[model samples]
Target chain A: MRAFVLFMCLSVGCLAQRPQPCASPPLLTGSLSVSTQSEKLMAYANYYYDALRRRIRLTEFGSYNNKTFHLDVLLLYREGVMYKMNYKNQTCCKKPLSADFHPLEIPWNASLLGQVVIGSSSGPGQGVLVNTWEGELQMKEGPAKYMSTVTEFGCIPVSTLFHTIRSGWMVTSFFNNVIGLVDPQQLIPPHFCQGAQLEERLDEDPVTFFSLF
Target chain B: MRAFVLFMCLSVGCLAQRPQPCASPPLLTGSLSVSTQSEKLMAYANYYYDALRRRIRLTEFGSYNNKTFHLDVLLLYREGVMYKMNYKNQTCCKKPLSADFHPLEIPWNASLLGQVVIGSSSGPGQGVLVNTWEGELQMKEGPAKYMSTVTEFGCIPVSTLFHTIRSGWMVTSFFNNVIGLVDPQQLIPPHFCQGAQLEERLDEDPVTFFSLF
Candidate 1:
């Protein structure tokens, strides 16, 4: 009986120390603020994520480079295609997107940093408790380092910092986040995208591509 | 008949040329980006405006000065009181607020700068049509210059620029705005605020007070 109890205690301790991955809700809408050394991009976007369908959509209204732009980007992993719609110019471009769909979650191999409270910890419903995780992503060109802070309760993303060889350093913050989709139709490409011109170049990494504008 | 036609044409032309004030929706939820020479503050807030009741409430979660802060400011013009609550610390301060309520509208004295399209004007549903207005605010300290950009359709605010003797120059941009109130109770002070300590200092101008943190 003593040995069994000792084993049970050890097992419980191991489980407590084990790092667990946090998965964000399948659908969410929010505004993204992306900042880099080269440029600051302020955008209001609705994000639609369908893990089962392996599809993602981002409709963004952004201001940068002294210009305002509206873009609707769709990544259809099943179709292996990416549609980039310029709502302002009424133009659409299509390119091959071969990358797999990555769910919004902490990487399996990411190291767990200490948990922290964003606001006050003195009372319930007063602050947001978040966990910070960091890891190096597996990439074709090279390894890219990333750190993310996500809420403990809902696993909602708060902020992300990414550094890559090509993109340098970038920080993205999420705000005004809602858990469910405001409009599921946002996941579908608009009718204008049917006549998209095919582009020869392969689709670049999402983080890098977004920084272009 | 020709004289009558000419008179009608002139009346129509004059009506078209008259400048009209744009009033924003009473309630909104959006994210704000405030940039100044001294600091850059990024915040997500919900604004509740009651024109008849002469009340306004702003609940903001902001990051600046290398720290994150949560502030809930309630302006009760009818009561002639202002409540500033620090959600992070569970502290509240109340002070006399004698200023009259100002509805979110383009100033009557503002000069019409121009009507411009924010995105592509090539097609319908492609761009946002906005009007730019500039004016000097009537202030006890001095005349403060201000400029505002608002969408012509809904009169939604896009950006505002203000230059005052105390605050210098600051630019504020709004994004992800929803037209109606998400939660009406946000206009009411939290339970903790009932025990607020009365502050002696008069409330500073909102534009200048926000820049402090």
Candidate 2:
């Protein structure tokens, strides 16, 4: 009986060490704020993600390279295409999106940074329980390190920090996330994107490239 | 008939020029991200607002003055007290709060910049409509200019930009706002704040001061 009790204690200890992986809701919408360490660039956007449909959309308004721009970016993973629409010039650039659809989830090989409560957890429905995970993404150029914090329940992304040699450090925070899409048509290309010019050049900036995921 | 039509057109134009003021929901919760133009300081926090009760709470995690800190701040306007709790040291500071309870609303004297849509607005339920308003706050030290963006439907705060001579510029963005309190007890002071030391010194930083609003 004592040996059996010891074995149960050991089982519980092992379970506590390994946290379960979490995946975000298939169809979600949220607001994203991105800022780089240099502070030269800042972006605010509302994003729509449909993992099942392999589509993502971002309506971004921010300053880049000292110039303010309003851009609408749509990534169609199934079609292997991306449309970047510039509101000021009424122009759209269509480019090949070679990145595969990467679902918002903690990777199996990620290192768990433990769990914490955002607010007071003494009472019911008090605090937000979140898990932090860190991992490295192997890109064609180099490996980028990332740390992501997500809600423990829905796996809704809260914030992500990505560091690359080229980009230094960039943080993307997601907030006001809703579990479902408000309009499916938002995932479709905008009216002005009909005659988008095809561009073969790929964006080398890690901040812009990593955003595809 | 021509005179009547002309009068009606002038009245319509006057009404269009005067945009209506908007107030946020009395009780709401959301996440706030703050950053300065200098790139030295950045903060992330979850805020709980009880406007009707004149109470606000913030659980913040960020780096300040090159030091990482986790702070929980609770403001009780009715009691005219503010408590700042440091999670790392388990210390709480209680101070006299002199600021009046200011409801989150567009000021009557604010200039209406314009209305804009965040996403694609060609179809129903495809975009978020928001209004921007700019105004100045009269403070004891000096006047600080501020611009706020809020949703037109529910007056939910989206982002606010405040500029002062001392703080230069700071932007606070709100997201994932949901109406109603998940836990009313969150507004109450935590148990650790029972014997908080009274702090008489007022913070002079405009970024910290304006956050009271």
Best by DockQ: 2
Two-chain complex of model 1, DockQ on C-alpha atoms against the true structure: 0.03
Q: Model 2: residues >4 Å from true position, as ranges? A: A1-19, A37-39, A85-93, A109-127, A134-145, A163-169, A188-199, A202-213, B1-213
Candidate 1: which stretches are off by over 4 Å? Answer: A1-6, A13-19, A40-42, A63-67, A86-91, A138-143, A165-168, A195-199, A202-213, B1-213
Please give the range of 10 consecutive residues that has the lowest summed lDDT in model 1 chain A. A118-127
Q: Against the true structure, candidate 2 has what lDDT?
A: 0.75
Q: Is the docking of candidate 1 incorrect, acceptable, medium or high quality?
A: incorrect
The C-alpha lDDT values of all candidates are 0.67, 0.75
Question: Which candidate has the highest TM-score of all?
Answer: 2
i-RMS of candidate 2: 10.9
lDDT of 1 by residue, A138-183 (tens): 6667988888877766777767878777766566766556666667
